[model samples]
Target: MHKIPSSEITPEHLFLSRRQLMGSAGALSVAALLAACGVRTPGAPATDTVPADARTDELGDPLNSFEEITTYNNYYEFTTDKQGVARLATGFQTSPWEVQVGGLVGNPRTFALEDLLAFEQEERIYRLRCVEAWSMVIPWVGFPLRRLLDVVEPRAGAQYVRFETVFRPEEMPGQRDRYYPWPYVEGLRLDEAMHDLTLLATGLYGRELTPQNGAPVRLVVPWKYGFKSIKSIVKIDLVDTMPTSLWMALAPNEYGFYANVNPAVAHPRWSQATERRIGERGRRETLMFNGYADEVASLYAGMDLRVNY
Candidate 1:
């Protein structure tokens, strides 16, 4: 894997300025003011225990503000409008959460929210490339998903991991829409789920996740598109056959099971060659695997990304 030079990293002072801007300016004014001032936002500080490599990605991009990340989201469980999710999910319940991990696991068990948090936590600064052709640099606080899976001990023949989100039509109005499926679902190959980069994010910016952000717990697969990282997880099943994801079920032609980020393969409606980074002025060239090709490219050595994507 390529290592980013220290000189390329954004300065700490710029991060402070960005944080200040987030607190003072409106969401619409943030990008303009920051660009004019030549300043950037900062992410939550990581503890000394966090590995140096986990503090930032190879891109050395400045972190997006808490306001932007929390306010702008793609959580369809709450709403389709990106900005409306935060407001709609405000009253949604996340407390007293428990995730059932069974299926092909030999030691299947239900992990409570507290139990999940009990695992050793680390900070990972990852770039979130959404399928919609937008991106964000997020400092996520969580442990590797492999750590949780290890305890359950996936049995032989467990080829894939299936994830299910909470189903509550009363709180999440979007769930009531019969046009789409309720209880969003996602899946990952066993190796992908076990990868070190795969995180079960509990929070961002050093604080507990809010309801809008998949609170309590969520999956963060940095190499793939943002939607692959399912939120508000309630069930996990290790199965032999590939599971059909919600988006795949909704639009099989547009959304595939392996939702990996591939700039070469454009979305049917739009080109994926470039992306508008949140909190930035203009678009930048999109990188294969969201700039994680060095780390995860080998996982698809014999496969075709265009076909799998």
Candidate 2:
């Protein structure tokens, strides 16, 4: 996801230029903001609050808040329709859930979802962007993906890791009898899988995850397109080479492996050069890491991003 390059993103580039465009250059569109499932309104009292953890930002404020953690999600398995997941996920069986780890790892093990909850769950308020173009500021609850991998211990041959959701047509009606692939598959490079930015969240808010939000357990790849962050994860495998992801398999060039939040590289069908933010706050200019670049960009130093992308 190498962006078009800063020189190409100046004020004159009309496609997504900062010029006097049809809409305000630095704010969210009213309609676009409304369509987002996670957008929140200001003055909204905390109906569901997670007390702030001790881990605070430079300002000494808690890193995450309950309202920001659970209220926002983009899980599509429960339903393609935005409001559907949050509603349907209530019936999800979280207590019986288990995460399966296998493939190119040394400590391949199957642990109950409860086992994952034993760690120190901290909050990280991250700027999340959906491939569809809408975005949000969410505080997530979970530990680094490497923490999970460390226990299972990926083997040397684990060049790529693949994730899949549990496919129960009875519960997950999206398992089309045809038309769509059942048990969607998503993958990540060894490096990306182990990145500190990746999270394996067992719960959001102070409660368990909602079905629509990959309830039992889910992968949170904040920088990659939402699809790369699969929901209701059931199987995790390590492969010797590149693994094809659902979006990539469906349309390769549209989603490159290095799906970094780059503003320069435009999607063939859409313009990611800019994004529409939601919540009563309105839209704002999208930053390099959704504003986390200064913290995560060094991971891609010498590589030819355009090619890997």
Candidate 3:
């Protein structure tokens, strides 16, 4: 794990102004500061040198401020207001959490959050492209999802992995909306779930995940849109067929099972060709699979992304 220099760490009072400081510090200082703080630009490869074992495919710009990352989030369980979800999530409980892994698996079992942490952890800084045309570069800490799947041992019938988020109406006000689906659900092909880039994130920026950021555990599939990375996950089921995801069920034409970031395939409502970085001034061109095409393109093979998406 890389540590930021104490002198370079932004003070609490200056937390809100960190973006301004980075923007004004010029390229040289910004590079050093971003590297120290684990932030990097998205269009280019990671500027900092991590340990060889890290296996992080971090590319592009410096990271958004921790404040920006936490405050500006889309955990619909709490609320749709990105700035308000954090406050609304205070009542949510993450402890005493156990993720049930069943379905088409040989050893169906429920693993506690602590048990999930027993495996070797790796840090991966990934670019998160939202379906709404926004993006962020986040440094996440977690082990590969495959590590957990391997323990349960998928049966021959298992072809897809379905994930379910916790549902507590009292704590999650959005449940009352009756518009969007509750207990947010998401799924990925078995191979996609087992990919090295797929992570069951427990923390970000060297800190444990906060309530708004999906405390306890969440999925982080860098090659797909941010929503595909469901939050506050409670159950992971290995199924024989493609699972119905919340968004896909609500609006299949807009959201697909394989929500891979593709500039060519625009969303029904708007173009996905460009995305506005939260703290940045303007939008930047969206990349193919958010710039992980080189590593994950082959997964699609001859399959048409337009159809799968």
Candidate 4:
């Protein structure tokens, strides 16, 4: 297993951690107020949260703490490499990096990353499974994708959401070779896109995203393989139909859009039951949704995930 750096808490990381500190505390207060008002908040059962609920491991992977997201990842398309993301991405022009939301929206508009960041971004420490077979427990820093969708106003016909990565091959060497379709494209079903678990991330390890890790912006889908969470995006197009995903287009049977982590629905050449955590000890059995089943299983209620997967 890869040795995860210890607490990778930088000065910026510290700031992000502090920000998470504030945000979570704020959320707690709100949830408390809602309870007082007889309203329900979406989360786990415990008013007294437990560390086990968000642990990313063998039998009990948990949601991310602020510490996880700001520190770990392998989003190279955003930068040349993960380490480069730490240094080069600092110069990233986030203000100009806007998300061109179009396709199936009532009013298609471009949203700047800066503005999007203003939304209630939180840290979700999820089990990140890369197509390469390695895994990581990442605490991604971002807000739910559904919040953005609410603003875009998807038309009733919108059934799929397409994500387009930055296409400036000159700036992104990976694009030059067309290792992918220049701009990496990924799609999600409407309900999946609207899931609270889905995220549009901007930071990890408590700092602004490093380019190596898909700087500027990226997507996080806990239920799917890592490839589905594209980085350095430039556009988000919603349509009545499904768009192509890199991994799925790369290998149909192996990578599906509904790439839910189910122990029963094994990858063509791999087992979904086990996983290797980034910077951790040995590989361990992966639970459904990386152990977030209790929190997210109902989202797929009555659906044969194994078939779709």
Candidates, ranked, TM-score: 1, 3, 2, 4
Residue-wise lDDT of candidate 3 within 49-155, one digit each (tens)? 23223233455377765666777789888888987897888757999899999999999999898998887878888889899899877888999999999999999
- The residue pairs found clashing in candidate 1 are none
- CA deviation > 4 Å runs, candidate 1: 1-56
Per-candidate local distance difference test: 0.88, 0.70, 0.86, 0.72
Candidate 3 lDDT score at position 7:
96
Point out the worst 10-residue segment of candidate 4 by lDDT: 40-49
Model 3, global lDDT? 0.86
Please write out the lDDT profile of model 1 over residues 181-200, one tens digit for every residue: 77899999999999999999
Give the alpha carbon lDDT tens digit for every residue of 81-193 in model 2. Answer: 66455555667666687788898788788978778888678765555678777665556678888888888887777788888888877776667544556678888888888
RMSD of each: 15.2, 13.0, 14.3, 17.3
lDDT of 4 by residue, 181-222 (tens): 556788888888898888998886556665656778889897
* Colliding pairs, model 2: 3-264, 3-265, 4-264, 4-265, 28-283, 40-279, 50-66, 89-211, 105-155
Ranked by lDDT, the better of candidates 2 and 3 is 3
Model 2 scores a C-alpha lDDT of 0.70
Show where candidate 4 strays beyond 4 Å.
1-95
lDDT score of residue 201 within candidate 4? 86
